[model samples]
Target: MKELMDFNFWEMILRTTLAFAALLILARILGKKQLSQLTFFHYITGITFGSIAAEMAGQTDVPFMDALIALVWWAMLTLMLSYISLKSSKFRVIIDDEPSIVIRNGVILDKSLKKARLHMDDVMMMLREQSIFSIQDVHYAVLETNGELSVMKKAAQQEPTKTDVNAPITEPIYMPSEIISDGKLVVKNMRELKLTEEWVMKKLKKKQINSIDEVFYAQIQTDGSLFVDKKSKE
Candidate 1:
């Protein structure tokens, strides 16, 4: 127990705290898409940062300053590359690969599939995930850099939009905001919508809702309509 007791707890705590802070800062600098829409290069960078940070957090023999410097330098290099990529289209394509057209005009491009290192089974599975069963249904399928297959269905297989028909559009801009959830009023939404409790009560009264408790859920539509769902007594 002598060696265990002799271990510098305070030093370890400082290292962990510094490493965590550095990680948070680095994550912010890297941007939200680092995890969300990750490319191959970014995926590797994320792993590298995690491994280095993990080592610094627990490895007492590893100097904190050295680790911190390494992390900062890496982040700076990443940012510099990102800036360069933003300026040069060629560099951007080199850093993050361009999307490949795997399928064109309802025909699978065998060469593209081979270059992307994807099999026919992989393509079919991706299509199935997107609710596409028949390859004939797909007009075009682009293999994204992040490994997602973006399929465009043929005209006959696609769903018709509102513009396709001569239907009257009610609201050009439609955004639904929740005003009440689980019998509780969302004050922030109410304030943003510039709605008073009296206004809500009046709307509720119109629907024969006497109390907020009656509402299990409620939302304000873009047309200034209140959609109130009453709690089921059952």
Candidate 2:
């Protein structure tokens, strides 16, 4: 009872608060990666990080400065490895496993399943989750690094496209390219879309916008029309 009474509440509060702030800052620096996007290496690293932060926040006996140093060092190492992975494809492959062809030509590859550490049951379950009941229905199934099953159905099992229907071929559709964003002309996008400043201005003028700055957002639509949204009056 005496020892419990002697505990410094303020000090513990301060330590917990510091740990939370550090964790928040580190999370921001690491960038946002969804659960599906996280590879095996990242998942393990995340667990280790959470362990460190939890220890720092809950353990009053641990030195605050030492805990912070350990936390920051771990974050720095993660960042350094991420940089190396970005620069070197080999390093990236080392960190993240290559996608394995678990199923090819409607045949399940036992060797691939073993290498991916997946069982036949697991594969069947995954396939069923994707609405694929039979193994013969899949032409190709890739076990992605994140453990996702990317399936390519056999030609007979796949949906028909416009080309299959013998529909009249029209002009090829393109992605909507933003020529202007937030009242600023995007030169690189303009060049990519092979658009000139004069063309952009003429489109804006059609929308009753006299100047480029008057438009907040402008994009080239798939139909080759200029879509412009005027800036609201301040």
Candidate 3:
């Protein structure tokens, strides 16, 4: 009985490994878009592949050949969709939705938002993440193919260009930081910086920062200096 059980365990492992390898190869053939910049159809293909892989992994009776066939079917379907989307604009529109102008000339287009099934709150959050406080600052805001917002600010609202300032060019700010960010660490940072928690607390005490939660971003520059940017806990 023990030998039989071990045989079953080994079979399961072998099948799982094969399924994983097959998925990886098929995914690579299907293209890198499977992992990034996914469209609506790409998302559906991912879900289908995941379901098929799970079934192949858990069901011992399912043949490895069957799994391979299913994977081939999905890959063919993905190729067909890609070909159609590339060859015809109408098919591309059907497969991957076109970019919608959510904001044009600093005016929020309610019709575009409704068509895109996005809300004002969602728009506001995206704007905030882009460091845009007011809609007036935006010249055009496009909802991209990957479901991300691409923002273009008005000329006046953008960072001061040389033409705007009518000044001579100077050296641009060069980033020289090895550690750009350290998020929420009480012990790890102490070890990394070669300082105790008590010393860190003392440094924070000078700036009236009582806790780590007050800091949203912390960076260590090449000069062995630390810069802290804190956000309100609220």
lDDT of each: 0.82, 0.80, 0.74
Name the lDDT of candidate 2.
0.80
Using lDDT as the measure, the top candidate is: 1
lDDT, candidate 2, 1-234, per-residue tens: 766755677677887899999998987888766122478888888888888998898898888888889988998898889888866656778988667889877888999989888999999999999999998888778887888898877656666786768544343243456787768787866886788899888887887788998887888875689888889998
Candidate 2 at 205: error in angstroms? 36
Clashes of 1: 0
Q: Per-residue lDDT for 134-215 in model 1, tens only?
A: 9998877989899999877766677769775755433212235678876878786799678888988999999999999889
State every prediction's TM-score relative to the real structure.
0.67, 0.65, 0.67
Model 3 lDDT at residue 203: 62
Compose the digit string of candidate 3's lDDT tens values, residues 21-125: 888888888888876647877888888987898778778888878977887898888889898776665678788887788987678999999999999999989
Query: For candidate 2, what is the TM-score?
Result: 0.65
RMSD of each: 14.7, 9.9, 18.3
lDDT of 2 at 92: 77
Q: Give the TM-score of candidate 1.
A: 0.67
